[model samples]
Target: MGTTDVVLTDTSPYGSRMVTVEYEGASSVAYLRGAGGGIHGAVWLANHGQAPSSVDLDRLGRGQAPVMPRAHTRIPEGTPPFTSAELEVLWFEEGDGAALYRNGDLLAVIPGWADLERGMPGYARDAVGESPFAWSLEEALEGLAPRIAKARSYWEWRHGDGAWRSFQQFAMSHLDTRVGPPGRYWDIGGETLPTVGITERPLDEYTVLSTVGMSCQRMPTVEQYIDRPDAYARVELAVATRHEPAEAAQLFLWLARYPWHSITWLGHGHTARWYGDAAGFPLGRSYAGVLMLDTVPGLPDMSGFAFGGDEVRWLWLIPLTDHELQIAAERGHDSLGLSLPGRIP
Candidate 1:
């Protein structure tokens, strides 16, 4: 039997007023629910099951001009305060490519291969121009629901534990895991990514906390700023410390999404000064920022890393003092190496 699932939900004004009814195999059904109640909408899909055009639901949510689908069915008289249950019942009882109604007025219609109309409300149609029709429920949800699909795919992929195994295997070749599973594995929330885990491992006398998921998706900021970014597109951050695992892991929290959050790429010899008060730093008041390195001179063999067909660069997070941060900022990160002999900590 086919299954039905709600793929996306939003509560933003007009954005929340649309709805979509999609086929579920031969016998099931699915839908998209807009947060606010509405009595008007347009239908964009047909019985042929061809994929809809891509829509940037993120942009649409900001009230940008709507991207039109190839086809649409308008509700001339609009709809009544009908429940989804009523729509489902109307769906099964009606035939394919159906235009449905209640009380002798058009409510909605499942478009068909030949049920094409270049019509939409006047205001939206004029603004978008020759775009066929106004935004439809399916198109919007299709764009916005990648996170849901990604979540489902991630759970499926997790069955093999390939990512974890790969990371652990790579890490164990250089460090030690006999200390047991990470004392803490930080999971990023609300992201479509398959759990980006910040796992803490033991490296000899020091603690090495590294990010597992940051490399799962290529960093866009990295692509925009770097040359041949694919080689550096994916990165995993590591911090070696003699301090508490919790305190050292704090560096990951700040620098984990640094490239994307700050709209830049991080690479070997890159320096990032702490943005907050000195007392709030992970290392202590003495350190003001970090210098990223591909491999620490005194650390493990953390080089030549690869995962999922992409070169995964390991950025070693080394804390720097205020004076060192200033030197790196003034002359360049490379200058710090010459200016301070024992700066690595």
Candidate 2:
């Protein structure tokens, strides 16, 4: 609410293992990651449980280059190769233990998401790389063939709608033609990438992000139908978030506003802030980290990207029913989480 600095310990109170916090004026968020992780059912959101200092609004607005005094990962190496406008998915490629860079300049690299569905997140670019060097939507589609095929199989099994809603206008949106890098059908199986008939016109253009060395080429954004018709179909589920009553309420309000609604919130400084509806901002967050969905984002980060610090962003598909949503929220259950016993088995 206001600016005030406080230091709090969460080691025993929540019985958590590792914890971290980011303070913005009077607000501070914290959560556990080492043990159960942030299984709060909101993707990779932030929590200020530890301790944070309140700062003056104007001073905070000066837009300080976030100085994470003590961080876990390293920054990417080299000078940025392109502007934030040049490409889509491009950046360092190493592991969680390495650093992150933008156009080659060292940026922040927090602890890698330990819980990606099939990959542990090797060194990746800034989620959204520039254009030109980055793959065109067409090129990306080709590289993503295997991933898409795999995802389609799973989707077809669960949501066997004739229209293949699982892909859900994925290709059409590319037709918008206003978002990221242009196309070049270099390896297109059918049409030349350019003639792929894709466009980026309708997209806010600002709300797109890319993924490097991931299961796919990019992680896009948007917020819509909670999970989907059955709530059982989930393409992505936030296992948890890191926030307390106040912040959680704020987040909840944004989530339960019905469909086709929107809101405007801060972008955690990683990217610019863009206005989005509160009703079902697809990309969810927690104090542990923010799980940005390529398919949908609750509030598509202005830069069309977000980062999860302590929390690990796991990708999967689970359409949540209202009953299920409430149940998970009430029990601290993750919408698409892997049960410990199940994981072990």
Candidate 3:
């Protein structure tokens, strides 16, 4: 939580400086480099299972930039480009590896001690690149793709087109009217990219907007944290509203990357507060948050269906006022009953 200056700083041949900063009780090396008149830095956590090797210390001593000391990966080529905001580069203790994600979907994983240690200096020597941090999102994806593919063959749950069809059949089975586009028609920034889909349907009273692609990827760490993780790890969100379908769709965009972006899970009786000013919410100022549930009295139950061999849960999004949100937090979302109480209705 806090840092103390311990090891003296060493400068790189490239003019970057590496300093040992003690975080909590662990020593992490902070790499600071001058870029475009500003100094930017990244920390390599000490808990990554290996310390800087002698070659690293020797290179730093010789005023040469060491092979990248942090754990990282290269993803396969032809993989979709991830938006800068959605990309996550993580170092994991279990794999002794680094995992890359774009909007919660795993892109690649690279082993820390072997592949990165031996391969990175080759990258530096060839003038290819030093770190994912050093490149733009597109450039990073492009550069890392082949290297990651070569190091390890990667596969994800949502690997094929067949899974989408499987989900569509399950979803349409519960709906009163099966007429609607198969996938999302609009693009909104900050939403999950290439891995999630939204479909809008017009009904007699309210328009229904549902996320189709959410269940495709399993929520990370769900198995460790939740009971019956198989049933809960895969979830999709929906909203039924009298407002324009476009307006209701904004709510999905806000939440599309939430579970993985936050490194958590969502399930029945969960609540998420609006990210910004309540007034800025698509449903308007009165609704300050959302309460997720598997059932709503007047709506069809779209849950309990299997997709990609995993049970998918469809959670209805009920917008709530600050007072209602507080009540749900204290008493539980079940106390709110099955209904939409916001002005958007």
Candidate 4:
């Protein structure tokens, strides 16, 4: 059996436009109302069985990117516009493997270490008649300064950082060869990071929020936790920093690769498993106990340690060891005494 859903019907100065969609098993069609409400722009969803929602149809009609259902939730089909700070943060987290696009054109696919060693020097030489390693950081910066200046205006408006300064700082910090062996290719950093790679893709707050809710409900397994740590971390950071959840989920869907982890259902008598070494302490379960005076010379009477809470659950890892637990405790001090979810303090 099949079903037809009129996802959206809109009338504008141009004409009356309605998006009628149908889904049956692995087949779907989006029929557009053309001139005089005639059928046009019929597209097929050959690989996806999910029916298009009203929001998706509306976005398509409005010439905006539509969201598609993937795995356990829906995600944006195209790249969304990203601020300079967001781009910088993403690049910092992803390193050279960050995927960048502009105006639906693939701009730069930042090469990883192996790729750099094998092909970067030749590519740079062919592009500019010299090995990228030949140029010092200053020379690279000088060459890229003009491009940086041009892109700086957009970022300055988006983030209040001085024109090109933020980009310059990021380049200097991460591209420095002196920091490690990888500094040999600092020139590559100058070439790509300064350019505005993001397009004017709209990100809706509500959509992102809904996606985040879905992601939380579809929790990853331990194997998935290990494989897509960056994706998980990015989403967690986004939620922590209050970015739209849908955007984070979209990013995760775009970037995450599999051997997905098995789902560990949370219930009574069920152990929560995660990544890292198994420590004696339970992850995400808060504990209150006095720090002995022998361990710490001076401490407040009421001061106690809590292992983990709702806010810090993402920090908990698989096979959490004692030393790692201590380090996490030290780092996660701010999360102490925070109430767990569904529990009264």
Best model per TM-score: 3
1-345: candidate 1 lDDT, tens digit per residue: 234333222221112222344333211112222233422333322222222345536644753333333243233222223334444212111011223333443333332121123444211211122233333433434432443344335435544558556655564444343234455666653332223567777656777677766665555435335667568867888877777878777777777755443324678888888889999998777889888888666665555656545788888887888898888878987776542224435
lDDT of 1: 0.50
RMSD of 4: 24.0
Candidate 4 segments whose C-alpha is farther than 4 A from its true place: 1-234, 237-277, 280-345
C-alpha lDDT of residue 230 in model 2: 23
What TM-score do all the candidates reach, one by one?
Answer: 0.50, 0.18, 0.52, 0.17
What's the lDDT for all of these models? 0.50, 0.25, 0.52, 0.25
Model 3 Cα shift for residue 297 (angstroms) = 0.9
Q: How close is candidate 2 to the true structure, as a TM-score?
A: 0.18
State how far residue 344 of model 4 sits from its true place (Å): 16
Kindly indicate the candidate among 1 and 3 with the higher TM-score.
Answer: 3
Q: What is candidate 3's lDDT per residue for 92-185, written digit by digit as tens?
A: 3111234455467643333222222233211111112345222223335565555354323323323455755665555655443433433345
Best by lDDT: 3
Question: For every candidate structure, what is the RMSD over all alpha carbons to the true structure, in angstroms?
Answer: 13.0, 21.5, 13.3, 24.0
